[model samples]
Target: MDYERARAEQKLQLQELENIRLEAYKNSRLYKEKVTAVHDKNIKRREFQPGDLIFLYNSRMRLMPGKLRSRWDGLYRIERVEPYGVFHLSHPSSSELIKVNGIRLKLFHSEKMARNQELEIFLLEDPTTADD
Candidate 1:
């Protein structure tokens, strides 16, 4: 009779452990869903239209030597914008075109500024010191 009571208590403990494990799984799922929602809210949507000037990001920059090497290539004209973040690009000087993911590109907003335009420099005057 003692053996039977001990077996019953063991079974109850096993049942409680299983319930705790299931509750932990449920809590983990809820945490992941909340985290995903927060992450999606901060993501910026990239939009590009055809004929827009944009720079292509070089993915192979780590293999090159320079520490300050620029990762972005010269502005390439968008030939076509496809569904699912695919962009057709072409260099202004070349007729050849290449298709690349939209994530690897950024818009160049230099249309308002002329290529040969010069910037005006302003000089700051030093404060006058009174000599004794």
Candidate 2:
């Protein structure tokens, strides 16, 4: 009788351990699924096309000496779209096209274009006319 009781207790303990392990596995799978769903939703799949003008972040663009330091430069024209969102850009200063990642580029809006145009016009205007 004593031996039978000991064996029964051992079986119950083993069953409990198995249950705990299964629960842990289920929880881990649930967490992974939730994380994957959120990541998929946040991914930007839209690709930039040829002829689209974008602003290259200063940190990403190669700097040249004696040039005005700008946080955002190059109304870069997209020459080609490569795999994995990489782009071929025609940088005005470089005059040579270069490949860059899409994350480093931001699409330019019409409002920004208007503002830059106004600034260019003001800079080019005669100073004598302003005093008149």
**Number of the top-ranking candidate, with TM-score as the measure:** 1
lDDT of 2 by residue, 1-132 (tens): 999999999999999999999999999999999999999999977567899889888773355543444567768999998888789999767778888888888887756777775553323332487558
* lDDT of every model, 2 decimals: 0.89, 0.81
lDDT (tens digit, per residue) of candidate 1 on 1-132 = 999999999999999999999999999999999999999999998798999899999989968877656789978999998899998999988999999999999998876555648867564454578972
Error of 2 at 65 (Å): 19
lDDT, residue 126, model 2: 29
Global Cα lDDT for candidate 2: 0.81
